[model samples]
Target chain A: MVLRVLRSMIGLLLFVQVSVASAVLDIEIIGAGEHQIPIAIVPFGGDDLLAKTINAVVMGDLQRSGLFRPVDLAGKAPHELSEVSYPDWQARGADALVIGSVALQANGRIEARFRLLDVVKQAELSGQAVSANGDQVRAVGHRVADLIYEKLTGDKGVFGTRIAYVNRQGKKFSLIVADSDGYNEQTVLAQNEPIMSPAWSPDGSHLAYVSFETGHAVVYVQSLYTNQRTVLADFHGSNSAPAWSPDGKQMAVVLTRDGSSQIYLVRPDGSGLRRITFSGVIDTEPNFSPDGQSLLFTSDRGGTAQIYSVPAGGGTEQRVTFGEGNNFSPRYSPDGKGFVYTHFINGKFYIAVQDIQNGQVEILTAGGWEKKPSFAPNGKLILFASEARGRGILATVSSDGRVQQHMFTQSGDAREPVWGPHL
Target chain B: MKKLVICVLLVNLLAACASEKPKEVAAAAPETPAAKETVAAEPAAVAVDPLNDPANILAKRSVYFPFDVSAVQDADKPIVLAHGKYLNEHPSRKIRVEGNCDERGSNEYNLALGQRRAESVKKMLVLGGAKASQIETVSYGEEKPKATGHDEASWSQNRRSDIKY
Candidate 1:
């Protein structure tokens, strides 16, 4: 009950968070030192209210990065990136300057133009114009951030990717997908019954989800590009969990055709069936390790649910998580150093990251009812579902806990977001 | 509450209104051979309501689970069984079990774990004599949840198979 009240409060806060315009803008500042970049984002070139909002969101984003500090909005720096006047910002201890313009375009599109200027280096680091639909303005901000991130880190950004989730609507549920920045959502599947798991193929071109539409739990892989789908498994006794093989040719799932649920490898075409788990009871959730040499799953052989690792070819198993909680749903990072899974410990469920090489684990959330954290292909961000304001919402936090943002809207309750592998 | 009430009323009225309209069309058009067939099939098409008929709903369905866990303690069981029986008798109706978890373990492990929970319920229902082929199961592991609250109650609610009938 207290949680419900807290969610209402946070729901109001989140409404304000997404609705309120930001005062500080994120400006790129390339400098010589590893020290934080001091930035001055002057009033944007177009639309006073929108510029302010953009500036504030960018400012908050950078602040959360812990690598930049915003200069005062009142600082008198009458310089724009169009003409080089680095001395004015440099004199104000500003390491960089950001300037932008927003224009409402035809066909309900928006054009956001941005330039990152370095005060000390006296150079323009990057420039780009992004076009987005009216419903995608917030997503445009994330794309702008992606550009800034690429300018700084030289790595691609996942800001354009989307997360798929499931939300219970009374006795039924809806499978929803939304942008990483939480905008332009569409319901892919809505069943008055229930929809459970949703997994993105490694290529990000298809989705594998579990649905009870057939009066039983079954795995179906749908090609997002074509809308054509094939049933991967529908075993008689129990058929669930469709793990897309990294190669996309096959999937490792669990089937209870023998009257007991066991891990099985089945061809994507529904041709082959091979059982790997010999356990007499409860061995499930088989995820492919990055190397494809091991499978991470859960088994009750230990008398309770715990994370276990076994050879990909099917062999003896070893327990990996012995912490206070019983663990399930282990997803190995693409890089394969460790794994991320749900931890049920002390009667609380949270997304935790564990290093397989060493027995190290850490919680990756600030607070408030978080579950089902999946990593972006870059492995730098974790996306999970949470309840805020009496509705399920998706939360994105930097994997290192450096930046956190909560996304929920009145359109519908969003839950169980799985980050697509690199797009 | 209002929505549910409206849905039930609308479905009932539509079904009832549909029954008379088809018969009138069939009787008047029976002179045409196509009309005769249409008239002949009116009675067959208006058999029973999906929700109101128990024998129809209990005809061809069951639930599944993993190996040893047979208690049906997972919260989704009660909800799924209702759907299972609904489809069992419907005969033409079909659905799938979407199993999930609370996001605590490995993806592969959770997949199986979710499957076990789903299959466990399925097996119990089969022994109780629900049709085997009428039910299919899918493991979503921790990839999906019915409730998003991070607390134990919410997680427990999420860690089971969802009935889609």
Candidate 2:
């Protein structure tokens, strides 16, 4: 009874978190990168409100990454290189500084010019002008942050990328696509049925997902541009786990029509169907390798659910995970060196990654209701589903297992989160 | 709605008991008018459909299973068999078996497991003389739950297959 009362209290708290304008997510970050770069971002010079909005986005992105530490401005605001006092930043212990200015162009486009400087060297590292429409202030900010991140870390930034997940509230379900920071949520589909396993196409133009609108599990491919959807797989039994190939020409889907759940490949236009895995058992959740030559899937043919790999052209299957616990939802890294999956052990679900060569497994999150892990396009972070305070939320852990973040939606339980490809 | 039905059934049972007491009290009186009324109501009482009768096994539609196991256990065999026999006798009624799972595994894995569970019950129904054409199976996986708790008490109830007509 006390637990029930506590859950109701949490429900009330979550209800109050909902805003009137849009469905905003509350993000809580934990841990930090090994080496933190102390950087300072000064507000842009022109368009005060727009500049503040963009600066907030850039600052939030950099801080949430767990890599950069925000250096206190202390009333020091410089919007251009000529106005910056190098010795002032140096004295403030800032290794790097970012200064920018925003202006509304006559063509109604907003342009922001940013510069990243090295305090120690007393030299400019990189400078670029990013422009977007007035309404896309966040996009402009993300672009600026990405440029700064790439300049400093030598790794691609995922600030401009998108993610898709299912938001379930009672009997209502919605397939939502949102910005990487959990902003700008757009509902692709909403209905009074369950939706699961949303897989983004390699090009990010479409999403293939499983829906129960037809009274059973069926796969559908819907284009984000036109909002047109077609049945990709509507077999007699359950059709689910639609995974797109790297080339975007075909997809692998799990179907139970031919007997037990088996993996099958078919074209995106719902033609050229070919059965792939002959495992007459529960062989599902097929994910394509980066090279598109193999598929990593979960199967129970070995008496327990484990990660297995089979050639894309249909060949001998090899077990990829072993010992201790059952693993599910195996997704290959962009580098194709290892794979991340859900590791279930002792009645707990953990997000774990296994190396293909050494067979070494690294547990990322401190085990909870974490499941269906997929890597970011840059292979720097892994996103998955997690439960907090009796609600399902989206969570991510860095590849090194050092940084972690939890994103709570405004309402409903978020599940089946998949990071979109690099745009 | 189910509780309403049970309440109505209980009231009718009590009224029948109250009416029967008067008949039993006058057992020594031969050819009583109350005995004639009882004889008249016997056929109507026997005419209730077994599927609608709470006392019959056919009224029970759900078959429960252990975690990760799809086979119909001995405890639920009679329920499945009773439905199977009823279908075979009627030859017109059809049922859809929906399988569900506890929130333990990945959604996709649980989906396949639930499908296997539904198919297992369908196979048993077919073996018990129900035609394959009379049965259709689907899996809701861990999406729908009969219980909302996270403990074994709830998980046990969630891992089940319901026969819906």
The per-model lDDT (C-alpha) reads: 0.62, 0.85
Interface root-mean-square deviation for each candidate?
Answer: 5.3, 0.5
Deviation from native of the Cα of residue A257 in model 2, angstroms: 1.0
Per-prediction backbone clash count: 81, 0
Where in model 2 is the C-alpha error above 4 Å?
A: A1-21, B1-46
Candidate 2, clashing residue pairs? Answer: none
Tens digit of per-residue lDDT, candidate 1, span B1-165 = 322322233233334435333332122221112333222323213455645433222221333333323346432233334444444546676556556676444444565566666666666455433576766666666555556665666765665555555
What are the per-residue Cα lDDT tens digits for candidate 2 across A56-121? 889988877778989999999998789999999999999999998999889987789889999989
**Model 1 spans > 4 angstroms off:** A1-38, A42-70, A75-84, A91-93, A102-113, A129-140, A366-368, B1-69, B72-165
**Model 2 chain A weakest 10-residue run by lDDT:** A11-20
Candidate 2 lDDT by residue in tens digits, B37-128: 33333222444655666544466789888988899986576567657766876799999999999999899999999999999999988876
Question: TM-score, each model?
Answer: 0.67, 0.89
On the 0 to 100 scale, the lDDT of residue A391 in model 1 is 73
lDDT for A56 in candidate 1 is 55
lDDT of 2 at A258: 95
